[model samples]
Target: MPKLDLGLPSYDSLFSTEEERQESKLEKIVSIPIDKISDFKNHPFHVTMDEDMLKLIDSIKENGILIPALVRPKDDGTYEMISGHRRKFAMSHIGLKEMTVIVRELDDDQATILMVDSNIQRENIYPSERGYAYKMRLEAMKHQGKTIDDFENDIPVEYNKTTSAQVGRKPETADVLGNQLGVSRNQIRRFIRLTYLIEPLQEMVDGRHESEIKIAFNPAVELSFLTTDEQYDLADAIVANDRTPSLAQCQEFKRLSHDGELTTEFIQETLEKEKPNQKEKLSFKMSEIDQYFPKDFTPNRKKDLIIHLLENWARKKSREQER
Candidate 1:
């Protein structure tokens, strides 16, 4: 009985071509037309003609998309991209008619989870992008049978620890998300809260162009608590003054808004109020200030001259005060 041997191919191996057999063994990859792929609805990540995109296009030209994108078949026969939106753009921009992709049949939630998970791994997601992506994934996770605890209050944040510690409960949504994201649960909640900002303020939070904000995260989160009109007023004030609110100022804004005293004029006035001890800066190009300096002076010599003149002017002022 132990010596008996059957030298026969399996039925599927016997009936199917090697290519067909391989395809049945693994997912089928199709060369899908670029035009047939639809952008994911309300996709959070920005795809700009930035320097990174140029590099991506160059890479595609040199080696092609080493990985096939993931797509879901729509009822109308077009494919909805689940991930690789950037790759899709690069391929289309580089004039590729078709790109290889694996088509799967997924419900909306499954597709959303896959989409978020895949893109969230990228290294340089902007703050706004991270906010919206976290929001979307949280919704998707909830819809897919993960019942997060009811909000302790409005916005469902600021209580991550309590919510995550329910007796006999599965990991809280924030905890799960934080674990996956390598962020603390509280920090994850903070990131999600950024979605409350209006588009203009959110753009500032994302730090683009002259409106780029430094030290805006903590203050911006506080600002998100304001009503829509209040946020707009604050955003307009910020743009008009070219300044982001400091934490203390943002706290006062929140307080005034809650007390029903916040208004456009008030916001503008508050932003105009300079903080104590905040350093003021003035800038001038050498060409602009060169007329004031001898043409033979180097930049360092000019700077030294300015410093010496300021010291002398301060001494003269001191001497006048003694008169």
Candidate 2:
């Protein structure tokens, strides 16, 4: 029997070649059946799949997979999907037997990092998604005995790690991934802030109404600064009003416990005060031009009358002088 030429390379050997290093860089590519794939249950991207995802699946059915997914092999002869979850769903929708994959022997942390880097670039992912991904990656890094502090030193300096250097003070691995993903470090910070929100708001973020939640670190921090009940109260108001509380509301939320200053009355008053004002539309009909004046007079008519009288007086004066 002719040997099946899989063209597979050892994970270490894949990175060793001068030519392959320059050309393909990633180790080996293969076609793996979707049935053999397991999920990272703890993944930030593992939110419930929605009907909107079927649209993405439809696109994939028409175009095939534009970008290959990354996967790591398990000892049980199965593959764990690292990224390209949308593609995976789409593939399953179309009944694809196998998907093109870049197979690597990645530890859990490496797999999560690779998955985040893969998807962070594709679209406007919700702030909650990025936040959850960053938070999960931080925990994963911690499990690996890797603090955000030690990440810079872990990678070989010669590996020319693309995003290792740009994280500002108090850098986390998520920050490094943010740089690699071409998003602002502050954006990474904001998403992680969402981690502190209670489950109800987190669920909102996981769904389509994420904008309904004010997700900045200040609001989150101020909200976090509140007691659990207080955060719940404020969050409830946020939901009921279909609007976020103002900075004053945020400040009141922070200072409520100070000698009973923020009361139910205060909250009601603040809501009333902060409720957006209804705007009235004004229109002037062209047919109503004479409403404020005589039959058809305006200030311009008075000016024209003055000009005519002056011209007549000047002509009469000129005629008298000539006579």
Candidate 3:
């Protein structure tokens, strides 16, 4: 009897295909020279050598970079890093000449969206970073033809079906952006306002300098409305007085700016105004001085006694100076 020849399929024939081979080649990681990779333009996120960064560096040194950074090729033949700025910095600090990167083709809007989304997941993000990132991503989304109605289903039917003139009157972008960021729409708007601040004022808003007074988010947002020259003048006043504006003071600054009367002197005087919290207070733990006072004595009695003793001590000092 003649046996029919039935050839078993080879492993290569079953598993290997042209499309699979192309995909495998695309997924391959390559080491690019560190010098060839440039930082993303106007990267809102900052890479600091803080304790967390030091730990990251140590981990990279002990076990080489486990994940490759994402980068896009530029027309100038250099790669622009989309994510992993800190990883790249750590590798460079570890004396690495080349770093592993996965190169992909991405347009400007796509790259901006990816960059902002990736960095927003970090544990610590400054107000300025969040502001610029949200702004960039919002712009990118708009550029990609995503309208506020796409992400927000809560829009009224009437509003959705409105004419172009009516649609232009809606400010639903903030609501859509806020939904993605897990914040109120107003909060998203406030953060986006920080992007208008100049670099110096923005750094102060970030609280990067220990010696400089840190501006709170609300006041910083208000300050962002100032013109470029006014912001510079306010920065100078902040440094000169070593003080930041309170929310109320910032409102005054904004009002003056709107009236075209905001000057360095106005900024200085507004910042110098004493806030309620700035008032001096004598603080003491109750346990520290409780033994000196009777158990039944009320707080008011204790305060009165302390005041009396201070008055007598002042009198004694005055007498000594006269003698």
Top candidate (TM-score): 1
Arranged by TM-score with the best first, the candidates are 1, 3, 2
Model 1 lDDT per residue over 1-323, tens place: 58556987777876677767556446568998999999998999999888999999999999999999999878787989988899999998989999899987788988888998998888888887888888888888899888663322334323347566435435788788888889876676677778888888887877773567443789888888789999988877877776777898888888888789888888898888776634587887788889998889999999999999999999999999999
Model 2, residue 213: C-alpha shift (Å) = 7.2
lDDT of 3 by residue, 1-323 (tens): 99766897667876777658667446446899999999999899889899999999999989999989999888888899998899999999989999899988789999998999889878889899998888888888888887642321113333345442334355576667667768776566678788888988888988985556688988898888788999998888788777787898888888888889888877777767767776677898878888999999988999899999999999999999999
lDDT of 2 by residue, 285-322 (tens): 64565554466676679557757988999999999999
Candidate 1 runs further than 4 Å off: 1-26, 149-171, 209-215, 276-279, 282-306, 309-323
Listed per model in order, the count of residue pairs whose N, CA or C atoms clash below 3 Å is 0, 1, 0
- Give lDDT: candidate 3, residue 245: 78
Stretches off by above 4 angstroms in model 3 are: 1-25, 148-171, 280-323
At residue 106, give the lDDT of candidate 3. Answer: 86
The lDDT per prediction is: 0.82, 0.65, 0.82
Cα RMSD to the true fold for all candidates: 8.8, 15.0, 9.1
Structure candidate 1, residue pairs in collision: none
lDDT measured at residue 222 in model 1 versus the true structure, 0 to 100: 81
Q: What TM-score, over all chains together, does every model reach? A: 0.76, 0.58, 0.73
